[model samples]
Target: MGNFTKWLGAGLGFTLGGPIGAIIGYAIGSVIDSGVSVQEYKSEQDDYKRKTKKRPKVKSSTSGDFEISLLVLASIVIKSDGNIDQRELDFVRSHFIELYGKERANRAFKLFNGVIKNEVSTRQVCIQIREHMSHSSRLQLIHFLFGIAKADEVVTASEEEVIRKIAGYLYINDRDYGSIKAMFYNEADAAYKILEIEKDASIDEIKKAYRRMAKKFHPDRLQDIGEEHLNAAKEKFQSIQNAYEKLKEERNF
Candidate 1:
């Protein structure tokens, strides 16, 4: 009876102790699992950083930068006309802010201020644009710059000269340059020339002359010409239109 009691006690102890041991083992396994998961999370974070650490920088400079630079230069010229008016600065500032956002706009303003203060050379920058950009790009750039300069709704001859010089740097042909100038700067005179009429010509005379010249230079008639020459002719016709518009504006017709 004593032996049997001892055997039963040993069997009970083995069964209950085995379950307690299994619980302890499970707790330890859970702790190890959590530790591994934490290390993996950290390792993933490090890998992400490493992958992005050596990425290349983006270059978003389109023709916009050239436009921005010339606009700044124009601002300097216009401001040099006298005191840099708030209107002019705001016009330029708004343009920069619009193009490059607030951060780059601030930088552009600072750079322009430095130019005005004689801390940097705009001539060199202009040279870079001249060397790198195409003739059409320079024309478009100067046109926009002129727009900004005249945003005060008035353009000085000095400002005009600045644009002309910039165009020269960009290697724009003398003829094309003259054509653009005549279009914007002297549109009325150009129209009078095209129509072979006086500035104060009668309205009937202006109308008659416009009809004759329009018929002669119409783009459809010049279809035989190559695209390049056709483009030139088209520009001429546009100039005529611009001139006529200017004359009408002046006459309030």
Candidate 2:
């Protein structure tokens, strides 16, 4: 729990307030219930306050804010379909391990377990996120939620519906939402959708759309979020590339 405390102390900012803070406070209670001393936790909290007191507050979301938000939103999406699939749980755990290492991932999963058992107010949570997080970061969050929904190789309608609502609440526009959603589906027009273009788009139009989306979803947009999220952004970046390449091939451009 030392690492967990350190992470909470250092990697959080705006998330320590609002609805997110309320959720995290509950999770922290669960942590205390699990045997971590309240004194130790308070000490860490005091340390964090001291460290951050002199620093100017920035609107950008911190890595810990993004991480906790992911866990909370994931819990909502997992339960959206009315059953918790072990495969989705495994996907979330494995993805966290890959992003945060084994120890950190284990600690996060402990919090996730607490988060998953709660009833999340999705709109309220998303409104809070929209206020603090960047548009690119929110898009990445949607991408991750889709990955969870599709973990069983089938994205259920309920899951998709819930994700769409999340996207809307996060202020993701229709074209952007369609573009990201296209990454998880194999429909005939998926490539066009992924590029935010149309099937009937001319070669020049397609090229322009590809360039625009390439810039929009570039991995560097997430660099400040941490290497793990940057790597995930690369995956989304590659999907755009693949979609563009497919279009180029089909159009003989």
Question: Compared with the true structure, what per-residue lDDT tens digits does model 1 show for residues 1-253?
Answer: 1121122122222111122222212222222223346554344334423333432332222333343445445654665456666777787778667655686566446435533443224455556555544454455455456655676767777777776776766676665565455555544377666455677798877778777756655656533222322444466567667667766777777
CA lDDT of 147 in candidate 1?
58
**What pairs collide in candidate 1?**
none
Q: RMSDs, each prediction?
A: 27.0, 2.7
Instruction: Report the Cα lDDT for candidate 2.
Output: 0.86
Best candidate per TM-score, number?
2
Q: In model 2, which regions exceed 4 Å deviation? A: 31-58
User: In order, how many clashes per candidate?
Assistant: 0, 0
Extract clashing residue pairs from model 2. none
